[model samples]
Target: MSSTDHAAAVHQVHRDDYGSRLGMWLFLFTELILFGGLFIVYAVYRFMHQQEFHLAAQELNTTIGLINTIALLTSSMTAAMSITAMQKGNLRFSKWLIWVTIGFAFVFMVNKYFEWSAKIHHGIFPGSKDLLAKPDGEILYFGLYYVMTGLHTFHVIVGVIFFLFILRQIKQGKITSDRYVRLENSALYWHLVDLIWIFLFPLFYLIH
Candidate 1:
């Protein structure tokens, strides 16, 4: 082998513990920036139509939003605890906790589906005749509401899939106490999903 090629191969043989985490963080940063842009747009529109925005937000059911907020928060706690359980070599408990987290995720989605269904039933969806007839500010409010919440719902589904993958790894003994970055990263992603909803509930359901 060429000496330069051999040297490169040797360098690649070393495992960098922080490298996986660093990559995950970088990916998360990009996600945050993407959401940040949406936040800016929402802010600008809200400022332009404060009263209408307030009125529009009132149509959302704060009760359901509150329930979802609690569910996501509890799910985050369970996910974090699962990682701890794994680190302590309690694979069975860790698996059980993750399953609970998945259950919470399902609850969140079901709540969201009902909420969206009710709004659509009431002709509150974007471009609906009711919405189109409203003032520009209210229209924008519902529009942003659908877009942001829809995206967040998509994330919740993705997070569920992510946890399922983690559970599979645990079952196969691929994720162990010493090598649990996959689970840790999934937990981080789930937390991000929860955090986004923290803002969303206030903006869309409670501000009125």
Candidate 2:
């Protein structure tokens, strides 16, 4: 290729990368808006039923929530590390860090499973007889609990899938030191996931 043509191609690539990052940021902004609305709703209800919210929060296992928080926080770090590894041209290490992030995600999910199972076993789920018998504030608290945390759980699953795809791309030599915007975007998404849970852990488990 001629020098001028090569320069034009390089400029096009840079524009594409910039566009991709911008798109990802816009998408993340939407996610934030969604969660932000829920948070507002939560705040209003909690303000109206402070004691009940406090009591309902006590029903949650703080230890398990703490463990999950740690897992997600660690996973976020690993995700960032994976991007750095890629930028440093350490493909193998990058892949390994991604795996570690996935492993932490698994840990978080497993703890969530047990925690949810316990709640269900206690008949505390929405529409259950036990939940229906609770005070309105407690009921509302649990309702928000399940909705917000459930939504966050879905994001965690999505983040895991994104990482899985990223791992495959890395192995296929599609994602590399020169081209890793996809990985970077996925890491950003993961960080958002972790951040949402940071809010959730305190709201649902530590309020008491």
Candidate models: Cα lDDT each: 0.92, 0.94
Give me the runs in candidate 2 sitting further than 4 Å from their true place. Answer: 1-15
Candidate 2 lDDT, 1-208, residue by residue in tens: 9999999888874437788989999999999999999999999999999999998888999999999999999999999999999999999999999999999999999999999999999999999999999999999999999999999999999999999999999989999898999999999999999999989988889985
TM-score of each: 0.93, 0.94
Return the top candidate by TM-score.
2
Question: Candidate 1: misplaced stretches above 4 Å?
Answer: 1-14
Q: Give lDDT tens digits, candidate 1, residues 1-208.
A: 9999999998885666588878888998998998889999999999999999998888989899999999999999999999999999999999999999999999999999999999999999977998899999999988999999999999999999999999999889889998899999999999999989999889888885
Give per-residue lDDT, candidate 1, residue 49. Answer: 95
